[model samples]
Target: MKRTPKTLLVLALVVVVGMAFRVSWNALRDVARAIGADHTAATLYPFVVDGLMALALVATLVLTADARRFALRVLGTYTGASLVLNYVHGLVPALHGASVDWGRLADWNPANWALVLLATSLPVGSIYFGSDLVAKVLHHQPTPAANAEKTVESVSNRSMADQGEPTPEPRVVNAVPIPRPVQVGFLKPTLPLKPMPAIEPVPARPASTVAADSVRTRRATGRVPDVARSTRPKRTPGELLQEARAASADWPDAHLTADRIRKTVHTSAEKARGLRDALIAERAA
Candidate 1:
């Protein structure tokens, strides 16, 4: 369906046909020898044609994983070389002792010259371009190695991940969910901005012991799990009190004491403001 697959299929067919012809030619040459006719010239033709086709087929397969730009270069090199060589020197050799007919070759124009050059040296060109493309693709660093390394390092990470040793579990915890303090119109206070910390998937084992389960690959809908983002820090007493005040604003009896305030306020912002006010008011008045 795709261009590469189609091209490969075509090349595969050509390789098979070319090889069949070569083998058939060998058998024909043996028959000619039995009859005592000069068959050496005919015998070599199939081998050359088949060898050239085989080179082209190999080049096409190599292009499958190569970059488009580079693959095109290699693909071009193979087709160009194979077609030329197979027609001229490869097929022409069958008539070795016969007079070289320049007029018959002229009917095909430059195709004759192309065949000669390709038979002699086009495959080396294919190898050069194909090798260059493959080398570049395999060495591409943008593709993350973490995914591949996951299989190798998974065993190593298992022990440290267990025993509550600060293992990276898929759960994100104790993260400040506030915007970073950025300069806007004025120096406005922002919720403490903490980065979305990296989370490791919690191994599906009991919290106490991690069973080395076989690595399983899963298909995901590409949503980050909430467990990977569910961390809230412990708020201070004053911070707690402010939250109570905000929630219980209408209740006049909301006291600033830890126990009373703890029951009253919630959220980081409310508690921080309430405690800051309470501490400063006592010092001033």
Candidate 2:
């Protein structure tokens, strides 16, 4: 059960205590009246007076904090017994024409004022204590508001304790949104393509110039320089004959004729003939 502040509980306790005092005082007065010589006591008077006293004492004991359950039982018995006894006593005396003197009641004193206060508070105190006792007996639970307050208090405590420690960073959940596909139709290009430009031909270099370039390239590349082409319209027979003879060394002796020399040397017939004759003379020598 959620604990409440002691204020209401204390108030209820005070009321019950006041009621108990009132009841005890009433019981003691009844016993004294029955015992005093001024009042002639009947045979059952002592027992009735003492019984009320006993009940009042028990009520006082039950009204205490630890004995709430018994309070209800004792209070019920006392109320029932007291109601019957007081009613009978008042009625019998009234029927005998012994009604209370109102003039005597008007004669006020400190004790009378006190009694009046006690009488007024008795029912109020009884009601408060009775309700509280019933709730306790029935195991009345705390309301949601009370529970909520308790929960808040507990949470605040936890937060205070956690304040001294490092707070963990909130977890970052990587929710990658899916890309929506675009729905587009294929469209033809509107721009026209231009025609390709025609390639122009370059003029050929002279044979002499080409030869010179080749000679220079050969020299630079560490290669034997080739024989330079003659500017003379007529070719050298000796030079052709020497080249043909050197080239024909790889051929059989029977293949070394004037026609083969002409084809191999790519020269005139006279030169080829002279070349072939030179080769034969060289073989004979």
| Clash statistics: count for each candidate | 17, 0
**Per-residue lDDT for 70-152 in model 2, tens only?**
66454665456445444433433432232434211113566435433433334445556545555554564434787899888
Per residue, candidate 1 scores C-alpha lDDT tens digits across 1-285 of 899999999899879977777655554343223223345644554344344444445544543444544555555655454444333434555333444453232237586454344444433554565466557656555545667798668766767546355646697679778987766667665777568989989757663453333344556878898889758777777555456546545544334344454444434455546664664465458
The reply for model 1, stretches above 4 Å from the true place, is 1-72, 84-99, 102-104, 108-163, 167-285
Off by over 4 Å in 2: 1-114, 136-139, 142-173, 186-285
lDDT of each: 0.51, 0.56
Clashing pairs in 2: none
On a 0 to 100 scale, what is the lDDT of residue 142 in model 2?
A: 35
Model 2 TM-score is 0.22
